[model samples]
Target: MAAVNVALAGRSYEVLVGSGLLGRVHCEAYSFLEPYGQRSIPVVADANAKRLLGEHLQASFRSAGLSIDWYEVPSGEASKSWAELEKLTDWLLDRGITRSDHVFALGGGVVGDLVGFACSILKRGCGFVQLPTTLLAQVDSSVGGKTAINASAGKNLIGAFHQPALVLADTACLASLPIREMRAGLAEVFKYGLLGDAEFFARVDADSNAILSHDNTVLESVITHCVGMKARIVAEDERETKDARALLNLGHTFGHALEAETGFSDTLLHGEAVALGMVLAARFSARRGLIAQSDAERVADALARAGLPTEIAALGLDCDGAALADHMRNDKKAEATTVPFILLRAIGEAYVARDVELADVGTFLDEQLRAH
Candidate 1:
C-alpha cells in the first residue's frame, strides 16, 4: 500500500492507495474511527457502487464489531441537487448522525461531493471519509477537501472546503469500472504531469498502454504520485488562499464551461471535457506564442491516443464562443470581472494568467468551433 499524508495543520489526513483495500475495511475503518471513539458508520453510496463492493464492506465492518447503516442514491450528476441533499440529510438525522459522527462516502465523485457537502453543513460540520471507487475520484476529487454539489448556474458553484478524515482509494475497484470511465480518469492523471512534472508526462506517453490496461503496479504508482502531489499542495494552500493549490485547476477553467454547455450530463463527462479543455488551453497558449504549435499538437495527440476527446467541435453543442465564455463567469476562480486561467508557459510549467480578456477568448473559441 502507498500512503500519502495531507498535512493540513490541524486537519491532517491520510490517503491510502492500494489493491484489496475494500477487503481490509475492518482494519482501516477501525483505525480511523477508533481515534474518535466511534464503532458505527453511516455510508452514503450510489446504487452502482453498492452493487459492486457493498457486501464485502458490510461484512468486513461487521466482523470487526462495527455496524454500518447504508443509504444509496441513484447514480449520476442529477443526484447532486437540493432535493437529494435534503433527503440525505434527513436520513442522516433520522439515523442520529451528529457533529461528532463520521460519514463514509463510498462511491465516485458524485457521491463523494454530495456526502461531503452534506457532512459539512449537517449539524454545522461533521466528519467524512472518502472511499473513491472510480479513477477520477481516486486521483483527483478524493484527495482535495473541495466538496460541492452542482448549482443551477454552474458546476460546483455551491461548495465548502471540508477535508475528508481519510481517503481509501482501493485500486481493486477499478476492475469493475467501464472502459470509458477509466479513460476519463486518465485525463486527471495526465494533468498532474502536464502541470508539474515534464518527465512524468513523457513516461505516461510511453506507458499509456500499461496504464490503460489497469496493470496493478502502474495503477498504484500513478495514483500514489498524483495523490502525493495533491497532498503537498493542499497542505500548503488548504483554502486556495495562495495560488499554489490553484495550479491543480490547470484544465478546469475551460473545462467547467464545457461541462455547463453540456448541462453536466453524460453528454460530456467532467474528465472528457477536461481532456478537451487541456488541448484548448495548449492551443490558446500557442496562439499567444507562449508555447510552440508543435507542443500544443503533442498535448492533443497524447490525449487522443489515450481515447479522450481532443476537440470541442466534436461535441456539437448549439452554442457560440461568446455563449461558452459566458458560462465561465460563474467559475469559482473568477474575481470581480476577470477569470484567472491556468495556462502553460511550457509543459510542466503552469501559471495563472489573470489578464485573459473574455472577448479574445470568444474569438479564439470561434476559430476552434469553425475548425470542426
Candidate 2:
C-alpha cells in the first residue's frame, strides 16, 4: 500500500494506491470518511463500473456499518453533458445531499469529472472522494482537481477546480479493463516519463509488456510515481496560473483537438489521442530543432510498443490540418490567437511554447495527414 499526499495548504489529501483496496474499504477508507460522519453515502458511478464493482464496494462499506445510495449514469463521454449534470444534481438534492455531506465518485474520468463538478456547485460546494476504476482516471484525472464536462466548443470547456477529499486507486479494479483501455492509460503513464523522468521512460520502454499484462508490482509503482509527480505539481500551482502545472498538459493541446475531430467518441479514446498528440509534439519539436529527430522517433516508438496509436494519419479522418488546428482554438490554454503548447527541449524536458502560429500548425498537420 503506497500513499501520496497532495499538499494543498489547508485542503491537503492523500491518494492511496494498492491492490485489494476496494475489498478493504471498511478498514482502509473509514478514517477518511470519519470526519464527515457515518451516514448513507451517495456514490455516483458509470453503468459499467456499477455493474462490475458496485456490489463489492457496497459490501465493503456495509462491513463498516456504512450505508450506500447508488446513482448510476450511462457510461461514456456523452454522460458528461449539461443535461446529465442537471439530472445528477437534481438526484443528489432529492436525496438530501447537503454541503456538509460527502459524495463518492466511483468510476472512470467521466463520472469523476461530472460528480466533482456537481459537488463543486452543490450549495456553493460539497466534499467528494474519488474511487477511480480506470487506469486513465487513477493515473491522471483522478489526481488532478480539474473537473469538467465537454461543451459544443471543445472538450472540458465547462468545468471547475474542485479537489477530491481523498482518492482510492485500487489496482485490483483494473483487472477487468479491456486491453485497449489499459493501453490508453499507459499513454498517460508514458507522458509522465516523457515530460520529466527520462529514466522512468526507459523503464517503461523495457517493461512495457509486464506493465500491460497487469503485473501488480509494476502497476502500483507506476501509479504511485505518476501520482507523486502530479501531487507535487498541484501543490505548487493549484490553478495552473504558473507554467509549472501546465507542463502536465504536455500532449493535451494537440490531443484535445484530435478528440474534437473524432467527435469525442470511441473512434479515439482520450489517451489514444494523447499518444498520437505527444508524437506530433515530438515531431514538431524536432522540426524546430528543439530536439533531435532520434528523440522524436523514440517517443513514437515507445507509444507504438505499448499498442497505442502514434500517428493521426491512422485515424483516417476526412479532415485536413486546418480543421484540426481550428479545434485547438477552443482549448483552455489558448489566449486569443495564440495557444500555449507544451513542447520538448529534449527527452524528459518539456516547456511551454506560447508563440505558436495556428496556420503553421495546420500546414504541418496537413503534411502528416497526406503522408497516410
Candidate 3:
C-alpha cells in the first residue's frame, strides 16, 4: 500500500491506494474512524455497489468487532438533493447514529458527495470514510473534502468542505465498472495532466493502454499519482480562498455548465462533460492567443485517443455558444461582471482569468459549435 498525506496542519489525513484495498478495510483503515476510536461504522452506499461488494464490507467490519449498519440510496446525480440529504439524516437518527459514529461512503462520486455532505451537517460535523469505487471519485472527488448536493440553481450549489478521515481506494473495484464509466473517469484523470503536469500528461499518453487494460500496477500507480497531486493542492488551499485551489477547477466551470444545461442527466456524465469542457477551454485560450492552436489540437487529440468526447458535435447537445454562455452566467463562479475560468497557457500550466471578454467567450462558443 502507498499512502499520500493531505497536509492541512492539524486536520491532516492519509489517502491509502492499492488493489483489493476495500477487502482489507478492517485491517488497513480501521483507526481513521474518528471521535478518536469508533468501531460502529454506518455504511452509506449506492444500491448497485451494495449488490457488488456490500456483503464483503459488512462482514469485514462485523468480524472486526464492529457493528455495521448499511444504508442504500439510489445512485446518480439526482440522489444529491436536499430531499435525499434530509432522508439520510433521518435514517441515521433512527439508527441511533450519533456525532461520534463514522459513516463509510462506499461507491462512486455521488455516494461520496452525499454521504460526506451528510456527515458535514449531522450534528454540525461527524466522521466519514471514503471508499471510492469509481476512478473519478478515487482520484479527485473522494479526497478533496468538497462535499456537495445539487440545488435547482445548479450543480454542487449546496455543500461543505468536510474532509474524509480516510480514503480507501480499491483499484480492484474498478474492474467491474462499465467501459463508458471507465472512459468518463479517465477524462478527470486527464484533467490532472492538462491543468498542470506535462510529464504526467506524457505518462498518460504513453500508458493510456495500460490504464484501460486494468493492469493492476499501472492503474494503482495512476490513481495514487493523481490522488497525491490533488492532496497536495487541497492541503495548501482547503477553502479555495486563494486562486491555488481554483486551478483544480480547470474544466469544471464549463463542465458544470454543461451538466446544468443537461439537468445532470445521463445525457452527459460529469467526466464526459469535463472532457469536452477542457477541449473548449483550450480552444478558447487558443482563440484569445493565450496558447498556440497546436496545443489545443494536442489536447483534443489526446482526449480522442483516450476514447473520451472531444467536441460539442459528438455530445449531441445542439445548444449554441450563446446558450452555453447563458448557462455560464448562472455558474457559481460568476460574479458581478466576470466569471473566473481556469484556463491553460500550455499543457501543464493553468491560470484563472477573471478578465476574459464576454464577446470573446461568445465568439469561441460560436466557433466550437460551427466546427461541429
Instruction: Compare the candidates by lDDT and give the number of the best one.
Output: 2
Pairs of colliding residues, candidate 2: none
| Deviation from truth (RMSD, Å), model 3 | 1.8
User: Which candidate has the highest TM-score of all?
Assistant: 2
Worst 10 residues of 1 by lDDT: 31-40
**Model 2 lDDT, full chain set:** 0.91
lDDT of 1 by residue, 1-372 (tens): 999999987888899999999878778867555644443578898899999989988887877777777899899888888889999999999988878778899999999999999999999998999999999999999887998888999998888999999999999999989989998999999999899998888788777788788899999999999999999999889899998999999888889999989888999888998898899999999999999999999999999999999989888889999999999888887877678998998999888898998888898998898885
Question: Judged by lDDT relative to the true structure, which candidate is superior, 1 or 2?
Answer: 2
Alpha-carbon RMSD to native, per candidate: 1.5, 1.3, 1.8
Poorest 10 consecutive residues by lDDT, candidate 2: 30-39
Candidate 2: tens digits of C-alpha lDDT, residues 1-372: 999999998999999999999877767667656654555778898899999999989889888788788899998898999999999999999988878778899999999999999999999999888999999999999987999999999999999999998899999999989999999899999999999999998998887888889999999999999999999999999999999999999888899999898898988998998999999999999988999999999999989988999878878989999999999999887888889999999889999999999988999999888864
Q: Which sections of candidate 2 miss by over 4 Å?
A: 31-39
User: Pairs clashing in candidate 3?
Assistant: none
RMSD (CA, Å), candidate 2 to true, equals 1.3
**In candidate 3, which residue ranges exceed 4 Å CA deviation?**
32-40
lDDT of the candidates, in the order given: 0.89, 0.91, 0.85
